[model samples]
Target: CNALNASCSDCLGNSKCMYCYTDNTCKLYPSGKIIPPSSYCALDKARWGTCLVNFEALLISMGVIGGVLLLTITGCCIYCCYCRKGKNKRYEREDAKFESQRMERKARQEERRNERRSRLDEIRMKYGLMKEDSAPYTRFDA
Candidate 1:
């Protein structure tokens, strides 16, 4: 007896339909009120359900995006650490090589100094500059 679109012809001839408000999707109401019944309530309930699904999808998408960002940052850190380790090892090897070269040069210089000291002692002994019983050498006067 209500307007033709107000109710589905298949469900029932009774035009009184339920109203939907989120939690309360269906509550009985008489026909011909300002609010349309059966079909309208069902349509509103379907719309609300669709909105909820879309909101859930949005949250899931944000989580995936955040996870990607976290993984990218972690990967960059690992790469930097690996590169830095290589640089430090190279520097240490170079330092060790330089130190060994310096040590060899120092040993050669020490040998030359010892030879000079022995020559000076021999010259002093031949010239009788030092007494035989005296210590082999003393500091030069000048």
Candidate 2:
């Protein structure tokens, strides 16, 4: 990796390399490690993959991004649970209102039925169609 020493961009173009400004050298990245140790190259001066960002800025940006994503997921879960609880309460209220309306309609229908029955009985008595007690059966004129 040290052979590609023309510039930082040329040095980091290779996947397995890091560039350091302190010594103006490009070194092979240590295998099996995500980031180079600060001892090898100071975080602020180390450039990898892109010359536009330093190692320190990359670490900070990645950490901030990951933290924000975690918080957003947690907030969404809490909001969903809270809204579900309120929805259940609203459903219960709707059911109760429907039951009350049904009861009122039932009572009104029963009262109307009773009133019609009484009116019919009064008409029957006025026309003498309802027989009195101790009456005898007899043939009537057409």
Candidate 3:
């Protein structure tokens, strides 16, 4: 009886009521009427005991799931930002390369133009198409 922690004298005598270690009490509801010694236990169990384990498990699972979701979202955001930054840097490098190539092409074109002009001047000198002052001759007929 001491080990069982029975509340009612009948429970102690007849071994009918089961003791709950969580609340340290015995509970009994006979013929739809609650006994006084077990009333507190019954009320407490009704309010907090029925769904305690499931509630705690659900709360823990939700917290874990929320944390994982947050981590995933943050990781994806960081990855996307890094990818965009890398792409931007790549684009900048490509643009710089293209600009350098365009400048080289322009320099080559200028060199060709200069060479053609020099050749034309030389041909004019060899054919006597220019005067002594290096100006071309123009006809004036009255």
Candidate 4:
């Protein structure tokens, strides 16, 4: 109900939009001119400014920054993947080294068991408890 006339009547050919005042008057933007319905609103002509270029520059700068951030995130993701792969390879190498160490320990234990068996056989031969070239005796045999 507060809408005013928004028509321009001046040499600049600018039109005024009705504002929320319900006064039936047109006021020019950027100019403090109040034009009644009977007179032309020439005094309220808007002055053209260079704000469009500034807005365009701001938009382009934001786009460039956004693109740079996207590329940086992508690069970081790739680097992290490479680092994770390297860590996995390192872990596999360590696991293989541990397995080899376990196998060596088992081999050493088997060698020690063979040495004890040979010593026992020599003792059996000396005591005349074993036949020549026979298998080693268990505890039940003695």
Query: Which candidate gets the maximum TM-score versus the true structure?
Result: 2
lDDT of each: 0.58, 0.91, 0.59, 0.54
Query: What lDDT tens digits, residue by residue, belong to model 3 across residues 1-142?
Result: 3343444333334334433435655443243543324443433332112333332344466689999999999999998999889999999999999999999999999999999999998998899975676457777999
Residue pairs with backbone overlap in model 4: 2-22, 6-16
RMSD of 3: 13.1
Give RMSD (Å) of candidate 4 vs. truth: 12.6
Instruction: Count clashing residue pairs per candidate.
Output: 0, 0, 0, 2
* Sequence-dependent TM-score of model 1: 0.47
Model 2: lDDT equals 0.91
Q: What is the TM-score of each candidate against the true structure?
A: 0.47, 0.78, 0.54, 0.49
Off by over 4 Å in 3: 1-53, 131-142
* Worst 10-residue lDDT window, candidate 3: 46-55
Best prediction by lDDT: 2
lDDT of 2 by residue, 38-77 (tens): 8899999998879999999999999999999999999999
State the lDDT of candidate 1 residue by residue for 12-119, as single tens digits.
Answer: 233343324344433344445543444545443422113343223444566899999999999999989998889999999999999999999999999999999899
Error of 1 at 123 (Å): 2.1
Better of 2 and 3 by lDDT: 2
Worst 10 residues of 2 by lDDT: 130-139
